[model samples]
Target chain A: METTTLIPTGPPATRPRRSPARLVRAAAWIALAVLLAALPLYIDTAWLKAGQYMMIGAVGAIGLTLLTGQAGQLSLAHAFFLLVGATAYTVLAGPTDEERVIGLGLDPGLALMGAVLISALVGLAFAPVAGRLRGIYLGVASLSLVFLGLYFGQSLDSLTGGTSTGRTPATFELFGFPFSNGGPEIEVLGVPIRQAERIWYLFLVLTAIAFVLARGAVRGRVGRSWRAVRDNEAAATAMGVGVARAKAGAFAVSSAFAGLAGVMTVLWFDILKPDESEYGTYGINVSIAFLAMVIIGGLGSVPGAVVGALIVNGLPQALTLFSGDLGWFGETGGGGLTPILVSSFIYGAAIVVVVLFEPGGLAAIGRRLTGLFRARPREITREETS
Target chain B: MSAPTLREDLVELQVDSVTLAFGGLRALDDVSFTVEPGTVHALIGPNGAGKSSCFNVISGVYRATSGRVRFGDTELTGQRPHRLAKLGIGRAFQNTALSPHSTVLDNVMLGRHALTTGGFLSCGLRLPWTVRQERRHTERAVEICEFLGLGKVLHAPVAALSYGAAKRTDVARALAIEPTLLLLDEPAAGMNAVETAEMAATIRDLRDALGISILLVEHDMNLVMGIADRVTVLDFGKRIADGTPSEVQADPEVVKAYLGSGSEDA
Candidate 1:
């Protein structure tokens, strides 16, 4: 036997190098944040309301980014999770009505927790099958959940208030202030902001938290493991990464966020009904809309998700206003072609464009724009110095 | 020659009466070999001689149809590759299986995953202790890269590396696991003479510095005869000769397999 000991020749230590382009991008984000913080004072009420919806959608989109982008899993059941949360909140927190037969007598906060927990549990149950199935199979499996949710909502009439819509009680109170009752008015720079402003602020806070958490998740070991598994499952497994566990974890996290969005939606609307035909609740349309947000944004990029939601959500509202004013289709229809159809068409177009031209989505576009701007400054400085 | 100093208390890997059948065809047939620890053991054979299959069996990539594979006290016969790696056995594939999209450092860090603690949450939060662990592992990975003269490309994507460099990166990745038994499956497969010489030096240096046992599978007899302490020659999924490199080289059966019949007596 020959005894040999291999001593690795370690690399020389060096200082961490910072790219100037990154510093410039950081500065731009700071500027954008400051500008957004000041927008309530100048932006009109309609735009502000749209902004609120955008922020809410951003939370759900971030979760979708993690599921599709990071873990290489596709989910079309996001809105179903939202439906669960909203319905859970309505049934649990609403006042008891013997005739209605749909009240759980749970506190609002507790109901919110229950909603999230229920969604997570549902995710956990489906993860084994969902995680094992990849590509088109996973997509089909998740799409089935949408139908299952719709069935559950319709079949359980007494629990879901049936086809006839019912009022949700104004019982949710925080710190002696009744949130459901529309407590206090908000103002910015002498401008009296409506209830929408209050909702906007809440959405903003949630969106910010979601963004930070998503960013943290993407930059860490978990993110690395996810990418490894996504890029090559065999390599990841050989490195001791638990592929199934990571996939399941992504599903649970995504479901939890979707649930949170559902609760937020209920807070905005102040009611939940199984029949969306009347009140817009039990349907496949919302599920499609949310998928549009994820696909339009960029699958894995956090910032891309936010931008995608804004474009997908904001576009239809703008188109609705434009069509009504222009009388493009007909004069009799004031609401214009249904918001769902318009949004869906544009979203479908966006998905195609992104897949063909820029697969990285809006995030890649943002990076290229920032890079171009940064390079210009450097070129100008060099010319002046020379 | 006197028995090597490191021979005492040696734990030899034993593959006994192993057979592997895929569908109707038999890939391996009753293969048996004993590889002594602390020695450079070489497995050489012609194309389709089931050399790769035996490597796969020992590294837990394939379960044998019959017989057992023992790496020291552990029965690695049916264990998964990752589980086998944790038991102090590491493998480098013949063709580089490195992550092309990841940086060299990140690729190496994948190997150190089994040693690291702190789950997803801690890593995401950048906890103080996990940060410390990450930095330490990164330093170790850098060291391995430098040892293989890959320091200059540590931050570069593995896709950007030369064929030989990429292969070395794979070897570095295996070394990052800190295994007792390292398996290099055709490490010199596509290397030129200069790269092959460097690889041989690195292999020798690996043994000298780490004291980790290595089993090299190769087709190049000159490279094998140069560094291998003991060479085992296989032909048609059966062991033909096993002894010192010179002894195996001089064996009539081994020479006949390499050269055509009757030329071996030359």
Candidate 2:
């Protein structure tokens, strides 16, 4: 999972624990975190909403990268897991007074955990099929889950609230403080931290946790096992990594992330609306969008996945916000330049550019840029060692 | 870094009349050999002579058709491949099957998977115990790498390594498993003469220092004869000779298997 662009020559003595380059990298990350934490203060509600949407994408993309990139499993069933998560949360936290839908009336915090767990269990159930197939076959096999999700969404109207008019999810709360606007009003830097501001901070915290956890896994023993399984099954087995278990674990973890993203999706819209078609929310298009985020970012790269999510999800939201001011990205009678269409074109082109010029994606390019700045020494070539 | 201590109760690996068949073809027919404890044993045969098949069956990658492989009192045939590591058996591949993109240290750390304990949650959270475990195991892995002369390229990607270096890295990884029995398949397969000599010395040094039994499969006869205490010769899926290197080298059946059976008839 760790792909180094700069190949250093010489002995291990040159590799220091805290090199100047590493300190610079650490400082840069700290600065980015501080800036993101401060963004909610200056940005308007619309912009915060955009950032929240991107955070949702970031969480989902991180999961996909671990499974598809690190574990080397192609999965197209992310949308199904997302649906599972969204439905689970809604049913668990929806008001018991509702006549149309089932509600466990669990606390919102508990419901969120329940949703992620349900999604992970659903993912584990699919692992049997995932274990048998590889590459495109596994991908196609997993796609069936989306159709199943669609069927459940329509058939289980009591649970899904009949796509026409979805159920409203209970406002999320941490202990006594609610994420909704009705809670005790709070002000940060004289900016009234309303629901939008609150949710933005909520998402920021979640995304940061997700990012940190994923990085830890990538750098730890679990990440090594996944990469080992990805590289060679026989060797992985010989190295004492259970091939099937590793694959199943990867699927479960990835699904849990997608589940969290699903909960975020419902919160973002304030409604648990299941997709009517395979092209709507929690549809095949959404699955491909998540894949696009990972691929455009770089397979198996934690931070790269975030950058990918920002581009793929943040672009459309940014464009929509800008169009409100420019008024040129209005929907056409036929198929003209809408924000979604324009953003789609941009990301599609970006994928093509990444594939052609840099198969390593943005992460590799970032490594190369940093390597150029360092200009250490000539890397030991294959010929030199021979 | 302190040297990793070998298990005191090292036991011999016994392959007793193992036969592995695939459909109508018999990859290994009644092949048998015993690797004495703390000694280097080599399985040598021509191309397509079931050397790798024998290795695979013993390593639990391939189950035998009719036979038993026992490491001391434990029956190993029915055990899962992943369980072999737990049985104190560590194997290095003939093709250097280390992950190419990962750093040498990371690849070596994988050998410590069975020894360490942690899952996604514990590792992802970097819990106190997991962190301590990682640091301690990492220290051992670094020592193993340095032992294999991979100290210079410890952080280098396996893909960037030379063929000899990559092969050594594979051995280093196997050593990281902390096994009482080490299975090395063609350790010097694609190496130059100097590299082959170095590998021979390393194998001898490993046996002497770690007190671990080494089972090797090699086409390189010089390295095998130099380091292997006992050599097992196979031909046409059958064990032709098993004895000390000099005794096996003088055996007529072994000569015919390597050269041509027609030579004796002529």
Candidate 3:
């Protein structure tokens, strides 16, 4: 039954050909990275702090995008995982001699990792429920974890340090090099690299790592399985992708990312204060903010997520920075538009405009722009070669 | 379990008096068929004749109420739907269930899921072995796409493909599994005449080249009669006739099933 006639006349091998457009894109990315790396040297401490805050949002948004966007699992439990990471890191690295609180006195670097692992474990614990549900139902169910986290944060006084007085997290360090001010007296471009500058560099490195890892995952096997499960469960199963396992893995990985973001959050604020109300830090608001990042970024696109984070998280920080100079949102406390309120209105409107005009977010626009340039010449050449 | 290795083994598929009931509705009742090694076996019937149900039962989507399905030595009934791919059972859906936004190559590479190893960590890290495995599988997937005339559109999104091309992409995906038993549900359902003829030739080529048994569910009589080595006719969840294509065409019950009971004497 051997047929010798048919041969596949495919268009070249599967190895990625470096076309002009690809080379330009790669060069653009490197340029952006270099520009970002140089920002700490030029920008003042306050601006650097604002940038660090954006990096935290970037890290968290990347995690949320992977779960909600890529894996097609809606989750409001991100804030809860963030709390887990924050508390785990604090308790693990806190002074062992503190009489009122629990401490493992582990090294700060190890504690950071421990916190991520713990958060992932907590996420896996919720997987059975996550696997059985879908879409908005899963979103609502995961929201319950936020309330659980709030309750735990208040009652677990030894770990969380209670809502009345939040515990101070240990300063993060990598070996002998502290991310804080005390480790070494250093200067970059004759500017003293103090707390704000040091933290900026730390957050930048974390964000970079998170971004690269996410891009890799999104391009590889894990991503294919996620998309398969997202598109059609029956078809995914037929293709031998374990539906439950993929869902679980997505949740766990997303939680780990969220957990790292949580550690960053504590570092940013210099405290692990559980929210007093449902609207506080580690509350439903933060969860929705992250979802906004993923949605506004363009669901399932890795680079899209970073842009989403910038818009969603950067808006408020940018508004606050501008408020100091431009006298916008001049009144605070009561009956006036604060920077937070103004930024909220702006991003909320941004989300509406994005949904109505560009559902694929800024990323799809970028792709179309590139596609427009690459379509005619490249496709024709490839077809002719074939 | 050691990384789900696959080999194309030519073995008989036995559906021993399988009965599938959904509450009061009997989707499949006492249906039995054997697909011998390396042959094209077609199951054909009119609408509402349980053709899809029978496909579901074989693919482990629905468990039989009674009886068994054996692929070689393995009991296929009650097996987890995902595990069937590891046993060399590849299925292409009738409506072309694929990730629309993903590239054709990505969708086809999904069929290699069972054969590959690694999860979030290894893949995310782009580990040395995982990268190698991905490159190798991608080459194989590209070849399968080219074999099905999808070579030029490998990077095109599945949503952007034509209806016939999308249908071929579905088949290309199934072929990526290197399956010993390939299940094609209505492969030529929505194709034009030329596309249907091309699909028929592709199917014949697949059976001849790969030496694998193909169990097909189709309504296209011309295509079925033209290519199928064995034909089974089903009516109201019951097997009406099973024989060579011409023999089944001559059977009165088979004719009655296709053209309503009023035209039985036609």
Candidate 3 Cα deviation (angstroms), residue A318: 1.6
Instruction: Say which docking band candidate 1 falls in.
Output: acceptable
What is the DockQ (computed on Cα atoms) for candidate 2?
0.42
Best by TM-score: 3
- Pick the winner on DockQ between candidates 2 and 3: 3
DockQ of each: 0.33, 0.42, 0.53
Error of 3 at A285 (Å): 1.1
Greater-lDDT candidate between 1 and 3: 3
As a TM-score, model 2 comes out at: 0.94
The list of candidate 3 runs beyond 4 A from truth reads: A1-12, A375-381, B1-8, B262-266
**Model 3, clash count?**
0
* Predicted candidate 3 versus true structure: per-residue lDDT over B150-239, tens digit per residue: 777888889999999999999889888778889999999989999999999998888776777899999999999998989998889999
TM-score of each: 0.84, 0.94, 0.95
Error of 1 at A155 (Å): 1.4
Across A269-324, the per-residue lDDT of candidate 1 in tens digits comes to 66666654412543556666666777777778888889888888777666666675
